[model samples]
Target chain A: MQYIYAALLIYKSGKEITEDSVKAVLAAAGADVDDARVKALISALDGVDIEEAIAKAAFAAPAAAAPAAA
Target chain B: MQYIYAALLIYKSGKEITEDSVKAVLAAAGADVDDARVKALISALDGVDIEEAIAKAAFAAPAAAAPAAA
Candidate 1:
């Protein structure tokens, strides 16, 4: 959700989603950055329309599902 | 990210994460489905303990680091 939140931040702030910005966002939140995963996610998000993606996020998966199950 | 969410759903739902479950979660969220990526995520998480992963999630990779750099 943080990633989504960061993207949300980027969108809201009218900033572009890039490695540095994402890193900055995570750092602001005192979060650790995983180099490999970050790369993977960025790659995954290539060409993705953040606005549409975020809109779908709300309806996407259950937020509490994984933790509750485990 | 959706992959992680699906894993979380698996953990919370107390269900083992199979391809089908991930598909279900993605379907529910109304998110775009990526078969290759989903398979890759499931494979990547093979021996992972979800609790540890989630706990680490907050502390792990920056939720927004990737695309911003790309």
Candidate 2:
């Protein structure tokens, strides 16, 4: 019975979105606190651009399925 | 001005968790696919008790902070 929890992050003032910062946000959001999954997600984001990631995910999301029939 | 999309649903076998099967699993997981806010998160999960709403959202997601500084 695995469960998935989802969240959005807003960083403290001028800090760069680092793995550490991401970790901090996730911790603040209290998500998957016991596992290293949050850390992994943060690390996976390294060197990647944030706005770009958001755009990509946002776009890809719409392709998951067609609107249900009426 | 706002965006949040997260999803997980496994059904089509015995069908019961309605709101039209969680609006057909958020329109088959293309989530927020033009918003109705996934039909208000499946009618606020009507009549509640899906494992106690996943144990109160996995224990209020660990109390939203407290772990960072090591």
Report per-candidate TM-score of chain A alone.
0.68, 0.45
Candidate 2 docks at the CAPRI level of incorrect
DockQ per candidate = 0.05, 0.04
Question: What tens-digit string does per-residue lDDT give for candidate 2 at A1-70?
Answer: 1112222222212244444544443333333343466556656656766567656644443232223111
The docking category that best describes candidate 1 is incorrect
- In model 1, the Cα lDDT at residue A28 comes to 93
TM-scores of the models, in the order given: 0.44, 0.33
B1-70 per-residue lDDT for model 2 (tens digits):
1112222222212235445444433333323343475456656666766644433323322322323211
Per-residue CA lDDT of candidate 1, range A1-70, in tens? 5666776787699988787888889889988775555555666879888768765434212333454567
